[model samples]
Target: MKFVCYTDWNQLPESANALFLQAEKDSLFFSRPWFENVATALNDDETMALACVVAGSKVMAILPLMKSAGNIGYALKHRYTPLYSLLLAKDDQQQVLACLVEGLHQLPLEALLLEPVADKDGHLEGLQGSMQAAGFGCDRLFRFYNWFLRVQGQSYAEYMAARPAKLRNTISRKKRKLEREHGYDIHLFSGDDVPHKMPDYYAVYSASWKANEQYAGFVDTMVARFSKAGWSRLAILYIKEQPVAAQLWFVGHGKASIFRLAYDKAWKPYSPGSILTSFLMEYVIDTDKVEEIDFLTGNDAYKQDWMSDRRERFALSCVKSVKPAGWYERFVASLKRILKKQ
Candidate 1:
């Protein structure tokens, strides 16, 4: 196998295209479209590239990477990205990962940082082993918790019936009160309609309690791209013909992920967010019939009420011992660990 790096998407070989097509069957985030949007939307001081390990005409593995202005390397990710991982072929996983690691080592970087990696399938463990064998000092640090639900072939009604009584009651009561007091409508946009409804989404987001987005056009770009790919599930709640709440979801590969959500703070008393969530949940469960529903990247109390299982995301930090920057980083990390223990 030989290592090859591509700084531009157009330079990718046909084998790279074939690899992504196969990988995306497991998760939409593994697709080229998703990474392309992320690379385009990020407005940071970093140079993005794709590092690959290829064997003749076949691509064995790929890693999306970015080199920071500070000379450190990181996974090419955006604030909105929930999970990131190395894309490796099913055969010779360890060998492929090792080759990819060798490629990463060739870059002029002092250290490598990757975050929000899902480890349920042992990918994290595999990566750690490869890095350690390559003589890098690595640490696995906790990032955040992820919540999800397994549909298990249940109908929407059956799933709702199994939810907590208080949650069910609140959804029913709040929805009715909101409708009776000030008539409301919930619309789910997908495919062709998504572009037209984006303005409403922006309005609702701006008025919501969350802080302003750091990257200006990231969400808009992602929504447009996902919509064109038939993976968007954007829902807006309107009261008196004005958008009061919005939620962005993506459905693909038998899974639905709740990507972003916000509600007008003025409507907090009416619980518009919860009411809208209920509506979207029903649609995904009954209409889309997804096998799993992911409430990605959080430990908010409300997430527990809606999700049946929990998992953790972690970051892997690897430092090169021979580099001055890496040595300083190692020292700082050691100090921090000692302080935490104290």
Candidate 2:
């Protein structure tokens, strides 16, 4: 196996793109345009160095990575890029994983930080073992559950019937109360209209609880790229013609992800967010024709109420043996140990 490092987005070989696309999952996040957009938006101090594992003429696997300098070999990861692992073929998992581990050892980073890794397979375990064997220690920062609802072969009525009775009744009550106070309106936008409606979505987002959260600009960049490819889905819910709740969904490859959402806090008493989600689920299943909907991020009550099952996501930190990096790692480990004792 031959390992190649890519410093520029254009330097990525076409075969690597094809190999990633053939993967059953995480294909959208690892796509060519997505990688380019992420590299384009990299911070000044960071540099892109994507690694690819090749066997003869065929690209076997790809790892999305970035580099930076720190007291140790700490690296910064893109927040919006939730999942990262070796995108490889299923048939050659052993060989691909071995090559990937070897390539990872060659990276200049002292510690690799990756989060929300959807370890549907045992890849994370394999990576950890490889890193440990190479004289590195693996630490987990945290883990969260990812919610998703499969809508295939189920009508809106059938799906609602399967939901918890209390949740159903709560949604019904909220819908009725909200409609009685001020009639509601729902608008679905896609294609060219999606980008045109981003300002409207942002207006609602700024008023919601997450208004102080940074990365609106990053969201815009993603929206622009996704919109250009007709992968953007925006759903707005208005009360008395005033926008009260909105959700920005990114749909592709038969799956729709609820990328971001917000609702007017004043309507919290009436649960406008829940009402909008209920309405949108029906549309997402019947109109949008997606097989499943991913409520990306969070293990909030609302997500549990709506989603059928969840996948586990993890944050992995692997520290290699470099003097500066080792010192930094030991200091952090000691600090955490002391805090836990208290």
Top lDDT: which candidate number? 1
lDDT of 2: 0.73
- How many Å off is the CA of 71 in candidate 1? 3.5
Alpha-carbon deviation at 26 in model 2, angstroms: 3.7
Give the alpha carbon lDDT tens digit for every residue of 200-262 in model 2: 787787788875448767777777888887888888998777888898887788788887889
Q: lDDT per residue, candidate 1, 176-270, as tens digits?
A: 89989999999889996887787888788889988875554777777777888899998999998999999989998889999888999999989
Instruction: Looking at model 2, report the run of 10 residues with the lowest lDDT sum.
Output: 69-78
Model 1 misplacement above 4 A: 322-342
Kindly give the stretch of ten consecutive residues in candidate 1 with the minimal lDDT sum.
Answer: 333-342
lDDT values for all models: 0.83, 0.73
